[model samples]
Target chain A: MTKYSPPLAERIARGIGHLMFLLGGTWGVFIALPVSVAIAADPIQLAIWGVFMGSGVVAAFAAWRGLYLIEYATIPAMAAGTLIYVAAITNVVATGENPGSGLALFLMIALFSYLTARWFSLNQLLDGPLKLLFKRRQGLDE
Target chain B: MSIGTVITLIAAVLGSSTLAAIITAFVNSKRNKSQSETEARAQYTVEFNAIVAQQNIQIERLEKRVNQLEKAEDYIDVLIAGITNGTIPPIPPRI
Candidate 1:
């Protein structure tokens, strides 16, 4: 039999990560679809929702992996999301139609999410620092 | 006395005892503080001596370097004198 050896804390973190992944997946599907459908008349609005939902999935995956590995993982997905939203905005601007406020909000959210990920990475709060704090003493190791 | 009165009296006694204990502890600590300070002073002296020794080593090293530089300066002065007297070829300082 394979040895099942993970610290209690790590096991808990992974469990929580899986739970968050499931919840975020469900939430993303439910929340994005109806709203995008409602905004389907406007191609720009639809594009914004599509990008938001796609990046939302990536962000959710990043969060899950961050917890699973107990490290701040790469969050370039949000940056890509910003780029896509900006492209959508550019399209609207090129067409001389106002892209409206919704796309702007999604763009802001993408930037904010990237900043949040960066803050987490810099602080290393959840795992790196806390793990160091509670590490078992080397002297006591068998 | 009622149970409430008795409890109140007990609490008051316990509080006063605790306060007295704290005061006694503080007084004892104050008395022994000189001894603690003396130990600390001894530790400080040891550390100060170590730092002074390291400083002395550094001073000796710097003094040796200064002595070497002085010797070099003297040699250069003699060389300049020899050049002035045509005993040695003049070397340009620019190079």
Candidate 2:
């Protein structure tokens, strides 16, 4: 009868998903920020980091602005964007250089990840899969 | 990187993101609007059929009544012909 009434198992699954996401996002920032700050030293590196991380920032901004469709775009953007940044970070660490702007850039990464995950969770709430499951369960119960 | 390069890169990234967001949003909104419109149209059709069915029932009932009235009128005409031909004695009226 209600539009949304997910069962306990589904709720638990969602909760676990969220917990992992939180741990990943939080720890990633904590770890990467120091790493970024340590590695980033040159203006060229800063600009590169900024350009890459800016994609996620834009996604986070869109999510923050409540642009639903555009927000999902963060997924691919983050994928490609994060890959470049991580590679750059690895290069810096390999060269024994500290990326001073790592924190600034990775901060955007954290925000983008957090927002996109929230967006996905919200989408799951409106998903028809749960509704179908509920119907099947109801039929069995009856 | 030069300040110009930084600004250009920033502009490129931001510009692309803004464009992507706008296009995605526009396409999705249009799709949602179309889906809802289709649902509305289907709902309207169902309602229209229901109203037409109701009207049809009324019309059928009216047609039956008309058919009965025609039969009754024919019987009355036969009775009047009998009276005019004097084949049956007219019942005396009680004044």
Estimate every model's Cα lDDT from 0 to 1.
0.43, 0.49
What candidate 2 gets wrong by more than 4 Å, as runs, is A1-33, A41-68, A96-142, B1-18, B33-95
* DockQ of all candidate complexes: 0.01, 0.03
| Alpha-carbon TM-score of each model against the true structure | 0.29, 0.30
In candidate 2, chain A reaches a TM of 0.35
> Over the stretch A1-142, how does candidate 1's per-residue lDDT look in tens digits?
0122234554455445334433533454455533323322244434433443344443444343332121222233233333433444444444455546456656556654754565344233222332333554543563
Clashing pairs in 2: A36-A102, A38-A98, A38-A99, A39-A98, A39-A99, A40-A98, A40-A99, A40-A100, A44-B1
Candidate 2 docks with a DockQ of 0.03
Interface RMSD of each: 28.7, 10.2
Angstrom error at residue B15, model 1: 68
Give lDDT tens digits, candidate 2, residues B1-95.
53334344544564465456445545445534322322434545676899999999999999999998997777777778888898965543322
Q: How well does chain B match by TM-score in each candidate?
A: 0.54, 0.55
Compare the candidates by lDDT and give the number of the best one: 2
